[model samples]
Target chain A: MSSPARRGRPGYDQDAVLQIAVEAFNLHGYEATSMGLLAEKLGVSKSAIYHHVASKEALLELALEQALGGLEALLTEPAALEGPADSRLEHVLRGTIGVLVDKLPYVTLLLRLRGNTEMEREALRRRRDFDREVSSLVEAAQSAGSLRSDVDARIAERLLFGTINSIVEWYRPEGPLSAEELADQVIAMVFNGLHAQS
Target chain B: MSSPARRGRPGYDQDAVLQIAVEAFNLHGYEATSMGLLAEKLGVSKSAIYHHVASKEALLELALEQALGGLEALLTEPAALEGPADSRLEHVLRGTIGVLVDKLPYVTLLLRLRGNTEMEREALRRRRDFDREVSSLVEAAQSAGSLRSDVDARIAERLLFGTINSIVEWYRPEGPLSAEELADQVIAMVFNGLHAQS
Candidate 1:
């Protein structure tokens, strides 16, 4: 349903509205960010904002999907699926860093969700599922004798992704480190460690 | 100045109040948790809260100090300061995990701070300074040839601590994993990595 008012703003589509709404949600807690505040941030009337999304929760769902989708897709990728368990784990790890760098704000919002709402709870559930998938992958690597078996696979998965997820706390695209370099360092540190190999 | 009402509440001392307040801030967020809500949560009058601390920001400073103080202490510990650079780094990393586990709620509040207030900014400044100190340790280890020189020291520090800081997300003191075990796994992963050593 195209309206003259909607057409007047050429760039402010559902995507733009979602982006700004996500930024506001990330800045202010999702519960605290009202649609009125989002509309104010988007420089649009409340009704105009509604024309794009059904509600603020809808915007959150869309934003979370942008992040979760990337991660879920990584699990299904040929690189993630085809290789030896350890190398496949590496592919997923690198891919996760790419998703985080590419869709930083969305992933930040996803990570920060406290499951206050059902939508948030569902997003968190999906996140947990993703974690289980990675954990299983780690287990496979351990079984294959590529990953060290002494440490619990679940703990190893948590630490590996913990370091990756923390990138959202500080990584900036315009900053000195590229996403590729970041992935390289993470892979190196988690696989080979900081200790010099003799 | 203890009033009859204050004397009536024997258990609600300043430390107790600060602990609950930190939990509230971590749950509801610092900006959103007003004195009224905190008072309601504490089952005390607003004035009772004031008797413990002058203002909300004062409570925040106390909570942040609880977290930052622990981390800052690690930098100066005899083990942290007196050992081989890499061993010292290991000591600090293990000690940081100890602090995070011991002060989980306070550290969660500290890590979640967005610097909306001057006190938060000050905390962030202190956090950055702590990061710098650790980064310098990483550099020292690299220089000593104990740690790999390939990754930048600053990046190494962030990943090391990032993995450490992430413990607050899933770690429960009541969980099966003891703090010592968590620290051991972290040390093993960061220093020796997850790959099977030949």
Candidate 2:
């Protein structure tokens, strides 16, 4: 309700602006969203936004980095590194759902980008790298005789991520199920499926 | 490779133009890909393209209907109506993969739409209706004691579709895996999971 003229610039920092920017981009799309439109959405002057980020691409970079950094960090986590392959795979899968739900907006934006720009290409490359890393875990689990060997490791990887990534399309923040509950249900379906085992 | 001036109007009917339009929309995005660009993609003049479809929204309606119609038909199939919930669900799941691969471009464009237009809103409504119908099967399976009761039917529906829908994001028609094989692998992983049963 406060006047924009009197609004403190510090109130809208880079992270805060990036959140709004990502939401706008998600709603209006990245190509259609202009700096002027972003300013209007933020209820702040363009100069105020420019104070923190140099350009829209810079905001994109920061937003994508939040998602990429979280995923990359999962690779080095103790559960991913030191455990048996099946356990490690499960760990990473759970961690991924955690990241997807926690950083829903950033990951949603990242998934929607199609390598149109240098920044987008970089995001795609990093996403591919993440997939490869997960594939290695799937392969390892297969080799350990814990995961089914009938399916190719790469195919397994795709299905796993496919199942996980689809959440961005349908998950609502205020939906009846919590993210943890979602993760558990996904884990159950991915591990055991809907068929009631005898 | 042919000149637009020499191309006859009959060469590109509504279906052919829709195929090309969906590919263009998938590649360039629906918002950025103009009718002029569609004419360029189709090797036809703008007027020739307009002769087949009144507008881009009309083309979108046709493309989306292709996917929605296929999904809607899954409800009435003998497998969907006459069998146990597990069998019925499996039938629909396999049929869905078939439809997805068969109509990849149209479904891709449909999934990418953000409900910005009345046409897209209709598509969204139809999509929700499809989800509800599928969820009913999940609920029925749960009631039949063939599916786990611990997981909410709504959650199961999201995960099932989530796993199914992710294929559009990563599936490659020319890749080593055929659509049938992809469906099989997805089914195996979805129903049996990655864990090796002792």
TM-score of each: 0.91, 0.92
Tens-digit per-residue lDDT, B1-198, candidate 1:
234555446478899899888888887778789998888777778988898899999999999999999999999889999979998888888889999999999999988788887878999999999989889989998999999998989889889889999989889999999999999999889899889998
Alpha-carbon runs more than 4 Å astray in model 1: A1-7, A36-44, B1-7
lDDT of 2 by residue, A59-174 (tens): 99999998999999998999999979988888899999999999999999988887889878988899999999889988998889898888889878888888898898778868
Q: Each prediction's Cα RMSD?
A: 3.8, 2.3
Evaluate model 2: give its lDDT: 0.86
Winner by DockQ: 1
Instruction: Identify the candidate with maximal lDDT.
Output: 1
| Candidate 2 docking quality: incorrect, acceptable, medium or high | medium
Residue B117 displacement in candidate 1 (angstroms):
2.6
Off by over 4 Å in 2: A1-10, A174-176, B1-6
Task: Score residue B147 of candidate 1 by CA lDDT.
Answer: 92
